[model samples]
Target: MTARAMTQHTEKLADKWGAHFPAAELEVLAAAGYGARMGFGERPALLVVDVTYSFCGTSPMPVLDAVRANRRSCGAWAWEAVGSMRRLIDAARTAQLPVVYSTMLDPGDAAYEPGLWGAKNARGKEDSPAPAAGPRRDNDVVDDIRPAPGDLVVAKGKPSIFHGTNLLDHLIARGVDSLIICGGTSSGCVYASAVDGFSHNLKVTVVRDACFDRVETPHWASLLDIDMKYGDVIGIDEAVAHLGGLTCRVS
Candidate 1:
């Protein structure tokens, strides 16, 4: 495929790396063979990485406003990405593809150690007052795109879904050689998944519109990095088309 053919991020007219990387620097990377497409795989599966209320907050609002509900909240873009994810999920389901979701174990759970997370981040865990938004389901996946019946769910500790989780086993069991990934915190979980998925030799494809982050910078940066070295960061429509092309095969 052409270099620009695989360059369709949700940023519209802007190039994913154009704003951040200087033209001369980007040219150097291109000369060094950095931004070529890794292409898609044969057998594909959808991996929804961390679309929980922690990242999405209680509802659609500004990032700062939603962060009141939960400091991890990424705000409005998270919900928008959720909408895209829902459509992608519907397309995948219609194509009879396996759908897998990854979420964090509950904060109260014995296995849910926040580690440096609780110490560093300002999520009201310290002597700070509780959020004005009241009780929130920090770990549960968002209702806008909850897992359907027969979908696989994995609770993970690390950023990468494949780390210390049975995600690899599930993918191997279903003969999933390609991953169409979506969901929140693109610079965090989604980027980590793309890297690990690539490390596992799986064809990783991250849906640009179907992923979000705390802000635009890291979000686009991670997608650019994933596209450069790890996976194909593509548009939601392309992802839907890819899944739809899988035929009437059973999940």
Candidate 2:
């Protein structure tokens, strides 16, 4: 194995024990390819992940307030991100590009849903509790940003959008070679999706203004890791410019 891969593996091991482990430098090797000035061909799609009720608002693990606090004068950062995401969605529509939405599948078994286990694990109660009935369609994407008739919504089983889903196939079918990823849990789902997107050869750009997490540290760290390694980390305005370039066919 390469020396960098060994370092990553070691970090993963240390992280498992609640230690302060850093991201492996191996990921940074892919960053240069997706920077602002790169040849990301046409057919770019906006991918929104897990923008659902369960993860937002007060459905247990709500960090909207924390994110809002971090944004300062803009008021609510989470709210702002969602608004920017909506605008990006509109831009994709105008460009006739695909908009792919992803959400956690109805986790029928409580034992399998980490979010559910999140409560129990956080409480430190010993006995493993039985799984609760998975959420129905009502628990789908948050009503504010739910897909319309023609939009594509994929149900996934994990944090990574590509895991156990046809996201890549769908993107390929639409001739999408670039991905503008948005949505929640920056350190978790967003980062996981970017890692897999790069592995699959899709040029990835993460809109920092459109992603959120339960904590500031992970959110900031994930952005740093992604910018330094997995993909292009651009602000919302820069992403808008790039998308505009795609339309005008500029560089």
Candidate 3:
């Protein structure tokens, strides 16, 4: 699809979430040299950041209800993104491209605790501990798009996977020169990681359809901002299409 077509993603988000991105400002921003398209690189990896049960909740439901179930829940929006994320993941694996997933360190672990997050989000241990009903941890990646045998799973305490983790080194070792980023909280981790990818001079593409946030406005705004400044925020179809043409960086 065209960039214009891709940009209408915000319009779609506005439809679902209820706030229009000012078209006049969009034009002004574009004229001011934002929103230039930097397509994928020859060797790219699919990066799924924090698609955990804590972000997804127990099942599909509205955000308020989802938060009731799990404070970190993005509600039904998380599940919706999971479907698109799964499709893109399957496409990447079928084409033999590297697929990497990131999750938070287990709650209360020395390596997992961070003061800034704790100060802002006081979600106590009772809320995040492993449930008595099942084997899943609060930080576990949702089972819908579970990491397979060869996929790389990185545990991180920070918003960006590149911070305090070997993700950059892993990408460098794999010869990955670009990234297709997906997964939770559009304004948080996904946005952080995509911009970090760009800062490293790697081509970055965030699959809008495969990412979610608790609410819609920030989700819409973050994607538009990323499209304008950091990277190409395109639809899942375009992301999977690019993944289809790539060769594996490793055997």
Candidate 4:
């Protein structure tokens, strides 16, 4: 098959680091092929996921250099995602759509630490042992985007918002049938949330410009996968426009 005609998963891998993947995901791609054309009804809520320090950049992952490069260097466009997401949040508030913020919560709640990091965690525990002020703080959101009054924040231990969280009930009670998800590490939490949103039958929309990941491969791969299988992947401008129309009707 031609390159564009390549199966979904192959195209996903190829789109990134020229990696190769099986065509098995093509079946899933076919099922979600028309996601862009999917109709989103009234009542949308903004769900921001895992935009925390430990997952974002405070930890030393292989992608940290890429994040730093995107942050303090020439390719800073990636870092602009934070500001873009902020604008989206503002638009959500203006539209009167329910806004939900999701972040990691581990105030002495580190239930899972990799064996490789055991010594580091132990040393840190021995020294101060307490959760640091910024990320571990009970009230802190990310430095980039802060939730204002009336905004709902959901503390989560796992990647999926539905896992060990009251997000589904909150959305259901608020009459929110659609979700606009934005945040860091697009491949992990963002992807997981979108998948769960799909499973729960919510109209899911992911903002391409407003979501960031430390690495490029997984970010792009996850975005394409989500777009092809789970939700509509659009720019923040489109997302805001969609929310704007809804807001005008309700307001």
Candidate 5:
């Protein structure tokens, strides 16, 4: 789909969540500096969180089947998001910015390996009946925007990529001061990553159209919350334009 179509789709999904906070309230928060924009920095990185087959269902997998069976799948919206995310990824690549992809790894086939999250997703746990010691097939990055030759892929065991991962160190080593983040389950991994990025003193920008969630309400709510405090929530077009501008200035 075209970028315009993707954006319209996102807006329509947000509309399903009913009314948002009043304009007056939003203005008040803005005046109080709650929604300040954390614009891009000289050094930025694209962080794609959990854009895996299990989340977007671009490929058939046992986990995808389970998600559909339980009526908790965001495949419809997530599949739409893939196009926009691809545009952003292409932009980042053209600019030669660091690109990182994160996928959730099942610690083991044991029930408690995923800890609290495993319990929360009891039906959708990553642990397959077969004893596997490594990442599952469904956990691989989606084909449309799979990691390129130099792209860093981090296997995370938690919602936040920073948890038990070298993501922060990697960013620091690359001198990444700003993060352009996108990916699945907007209310979960994306939200957690944005919050952690902010706490770590990095500028965070969330591509609103490039993130998806199983439910609309939490997705919209999380975007609003992140825009208010953690970072800026912008459309994919804006993100691409920003990356293009960065490339121009660098060149």
Candidate 6:
């Protein structure tokens, strides 16, 4: 679909579900000091969450096939957001800021372990049934914006990157006080990471256009909720501009 048509389609979904908050509500919240800006910090890092083929469908995999069967998949939208994310990544790299990535890698034998959230969410399935035979590297990051040398790549099993990873310690060690997050699905991993970042006292900025969700309403709702309570939901250009405004640093 054309970009204009896709936007109109998303708007229709948002309107139908009341996903867009009323302007009056926002005004009242602002008056109540609820949506106050925290602004960017001296040291900021880019946290790209779950830009993997399993979610984006950049490659064929059993998980992708199942997700596609659900009809609620947003693979196309996720693919669309990739360019914007690349721009943010490039800007962050140029500013000499740390770039971190989170991927939900295959858990191998742990796939059979009970209480796996992804498995539990699979309509109560014990595990995602792999294809009878095919390539299975669905957890790999999309090639266009894969992590480069010197970039931190964390393999996480849960939706929130910080839940079972050393992401927090790494950020603290790097002196990062702010986080710029982008990836898919917005209402899932992105939302979880943003909330965790807020809870950690880190200033969080979510690049809205650089994030995608399996469904449009939840995407809009999640962004609104994050903007109001957890972090600022901004556009890609605004994020890149902020990075560009940073002083050049010796790498």
Compute each candidate's TM-score over C-alphas. 0.87, 0.68, 0.88, 0.72, 0.81, 0.80
Clashing pairs in 6: none
lDDT-wise, the better of 1 and 4 is 1
**TM-score, cand. 3 vs. native:** 0.88
Model 6 lDDT at residue 188: 90
What's the C-alpha lDDT at position 126 in model 5? 40
Error at 218, model 3, angstroms: 0.7
lDDT, model 1? 0.81
For model 4, how does the per-residue alpha-carbon lDDT over 87-122 read when each residue is reduced to its tens digit? 888888888888888876554555533233335343
lDDT of 3 at 150: 89
Error of 2 at 243 (Å): 2.4
Rank list by lDDT = 3, 1, 5, 6, 4, 2
RMSD of 3: 4.5
Model 6 Cα lDDT, one tens digit per residue, 131-196: 313553566788989999999998886779998789999999999999999998889999999999
Off by over 4 Å in 2: 1-39, 58-77, 109-120, 123-138, 248-251
TM-score of 5: 0.81
Which run of 10 residues does model 5 get worst, by summed lDDT? 9-18
Cα displacement (Å) at residue 58, model 5: 3.5
Q: Which candidate is the best by TM-score?
A: 3
| lDDT score of residue 19 within candidate 2 | 35
lDDT of 3 by residue, 67-182 (tens): 87777899999999999999999999888888999998876566756647766765654444345367877787888999999899999988998998988999999888999999
Local lDDT at 144 for model 3:
90
* lDDT, residue 64, candidate 4: 44
lDDT of 5 by residue, 183-245 (tens): 978999999999999999999999999999876789888988898789988898889998998
Better of 1 and 5 by TM-score: 1
Off by over 4 Å in 3: 1-19, 122-132, 247-251
Q: In model 5, state the lDDT of residue 232.
A: 86
